[model samples]
Target: MAGLERQLTLRFLAEPADVNFGGKVHGGAVMKWIDLAGYACAAGWSGKYCITAYAGGIRFVKPIHVGNIVEVTAKVIYTGRTSMHLGVDVKAGDPKDQDRHLTTHCVLVMVAVDDEGQPTEVPDWKPELPADIELRESAIRLMEMRKKIGAEMQAHVDLQPSLQVP
Candidate 1:
């Protein structure tokens, strides 16, 4: 089903605090924006408090200079019992330059929570008419990838040696 789209955009002015000595926006700052946007989208979609559980395939495609306007678009791609997958795309460019747009895409997994701050199932989802086929396909692929990654993480944890102090 074609899911919901929610976006948050901000013009990040690179102050010295946000930039490195090399004069580019810090990756950590960009990552913070990404996570915030992702969570905002998730909360809006689920109409409940949501926490980020996973971020997949995050790549910084280009660098942002001091005056670049970063636009972040977040959307609900899929939903499970208590989890929702969000796709966030970050673009860096001058706001005046409408022609320049480069996509920095990342997928985030978020879980809805109840008023007691416990995990809760998402509300019923019914796709609107005239859904986008390509978007649905992409969301499906992402969901599969997320499941595979979760399994791998569990296996890795299982393999870790336990330390027992004598």
Candidate 2:
């Protein structure tokens, strides 16, 4: 935490519009928050406007109520030449309560782009603290998982026979 200066923790209350009829916050709304946090953290780290290239391994561990105090944190755990892997965690609970439960966790890959929308290089990040090192390793493993899932999805699409171009 001391070495990683480019991190952000955004705290706010979930609004009624973020909730669904089931009386819980919508997953899409939470995802939108995650993307926003990731974008901010990545952009801060890269010092350039970044676009979300991929997001995966999203875990919705608990539910968030409409009026819950939402705590969203995003950090650049790893970085490539042009990409920054961000770990975004979202937690929610009552403002009066002492315990805030973890609601969602995700990995977002954001790529810096130039004026032409082409990928541009970003500064490298090296993990310093033990927790940071663990996060960096976790990001590497998650990237592998993303590649595996992407390959499987491509294979499945190739197997589908709906491409008869007349």
Of the candidates shown, which would achieve the greatest TM-score relative to the real structure?
A: 2
In candidate 2, stretches whose alpha carbon ends up further than 4 angstroms from where it belongs are 1-4, 163-166
Worst 10 residues of 1 by lDDT: 1-10
Compute the lDDT for candidate 2: 0.90
lDDT of 2 at 89: 92
Tens digit per residue, CA lDDT, model 2, 80-104: 9999999899999999987899999
- List candidate 1 segments past 4 Å from native: 1-5, 8-11, 124-131, 164-166
Question: Model 1: per-residue lDDT, tens digit, 1-166?
Answer: 1224444454454466778777888888877888888887778777788998888888888877767777777776667788877777888777567644654778888898998989998754544545534555677887787789889999999999998898
lDDT of 1 at 48: 84
- lDDT over C-alpha atoms for residue 78 of model 2: 92
